[model samples]
Target: MSSARENNPPAKTGAARKARPLKTRTYGLFRWLHVYISMFSLLIVLFFSVTGITLNHPDWVFGNVETRQEYSGTLPEGWKTGNQVNWLKVVEHVRATHNVKGSVADDGYQSDEQQASVAFHGPGYAADVFIEMGTGKYTVNVDAQGAVAVMNDLHKGRDTSPLWKWVIDLSAGFLTLVSLTGLGLLIFLKKIRPAGLITAAAGGVLVLLLMRLAS
Candidate 1:
């Protein structure tokens, strides 16, 4: 039995199998691919990541954003000083004077308050104009510039040209590919990549939480 065992090939143990050297070429290829993809998308990645951080800590990043915009425009023809106001002339006048890239449509009228309102959605923002028919004064409130708002609006292709939207969609697809390749490389080196599992689990949880919250 001893002679037969000696002649037979030794069974490979886990340690022996693990001790086998990693393929340098395969490792190099993965690293090269990762580096190239990261370099190609560096700017977009940086922008999105920074914006993410900023969004997470909004108070620190956006405490000083503008909140209101008020402009006085003289009423044009068919508009009255004290009589009931016309919304079409107001919208056209505001677009001409203040560069409002939106159409003004009738929102509603309040009988008790004797007021009329119009709504406008622009490239980066939306505004509702409320005019106190009795006072002949208008008040406009604008939202704070937020990272999520900016990112989401970009994702929705709001007011963007068709070509720009296409670019964003293509870049998003490339980002997914890069991320997947990185995860695969990580799986191959999990044993030596200290804290790799922990880091990956944490990242997965974070993504899930963020997506849930966003949805």
Candidate 2:
């Protein structure tokens, strides 16, 4: 019986070796994904993290210097034929003359009073134009809140273009993938898994406690 058991030990060891390859392959794939995704999202992660700090402490990031510019001009006479105001022409003319940077956010016309107002919005910048319909007189006010404010707005996706919003979405997805794969890799590390999970749990609990305390 002892001789038979010793011979069977080789068979058991071979089976274990076969199982090991599958586990190793899965771990390798996860590590690969974690490394590459983290690489791709590194800059995006840094930007959002830094901007998050700046956002939380706005006074530290930006000074109180806001720039305001005012311009008065006359719109094309043909814009108001009767009671109708050609808003497209007005927008185009204003954009061309003043070098406006953003898309038109609102165009409000008070037909009863023959008054038109248009607002343009972008990251940390706004422009408002008020026009008198029949007389073609218009006033433009542009407000710019500087570069730090622009970066903060970009982080929040405020007044940003659709393409930038897509970039934010993609960055978020990649970051999620990176985090999951990193956690998966930790599971394979026998010596470190317990400590890593405990640390993660502690960090999460700390955040929850902070939130609860604030509330």
Candidate 3:
């Protein structure tokens, strides 16, 4: 062993021996993943960001939207099949007749003593139709959601249908992994040790506090 040590000179030093190759590799992989995904999703990120800013400050600078929609539907065989009306058919008919270029927005169901209503808000406008399942009196309300409505409206796209939306959820999950790996890397690097821990802890506490407050 001594002869071998003398001949090879023990390549790894004390500091090198303590180093974590697995951690470094994981960090590097996650960093690359984060970069590529961020690049691919840059437009989406910017879209959300712009909408967020506009949503936050509505009064200062706001834009107007003009909505014109004509809808007519002959009742399908089971119009109220499965206790839910065929809202999609109505939306599709509107789109085909009106020549809407963008996606359809599906807000939650609106129900009251007189009518059960379904609402859809899309780019530049919105449409809500109350169809009496029993009597078949159709009423449509189409309007715009200024800036705040636009952000809220974006959440309603048919894009939520799990085909492309899966990419979004997947990216979000990987972003969490990327963040964790970055934290690990920061901890592994001794120079920036306490700062990383303090920032992470403070961020976590702030997020928890905000969630609690929101709830």
**TM-scores for all predictions:** 0.50, 0.85, 0.53
lDDT of 3 by residue, 86-134 (tens): 6667556545654443444444565544566766644456566677766
- Which residue pairs come into collision in candidate 2? none
Instruction: Return the lDDT, model 2, position 192.
Output: 100
Regions more than 4 Å wrong, model 1 = 1-33, 61-63, 78-90, 101-114, 121-126, 131-171, 186-215
Best-fitting candidate, measured by lDDT?
Answer: 2
Which window of 10 residues has the lowest lDDT sum in candidate 1? 103-112
What's model 3's lDDT at 63? 55
> lDDT score, residue 100, model 1?
55
Write one digit per residue (lDDT tens) for candidate 1, span 1-215. Answer: 99999899789988777553567666777778888988998887676666566556646744334455665544456644446566557767667776655434334333235766666754456666666666656655444344455554565566456676787777787688788778767867958566786788899999999999999
Q: What lDDT is reached at residue 75 by model 1?
A: 48
lDDT of 2 by residue, 1-215 (tens): 89998877655456566455778999999999999999989999889888898899888745536799999999976776677778788888999999977876554334446677888889999998888876889999999997778889999999999999998999899989998999999999999999999999999999999999999
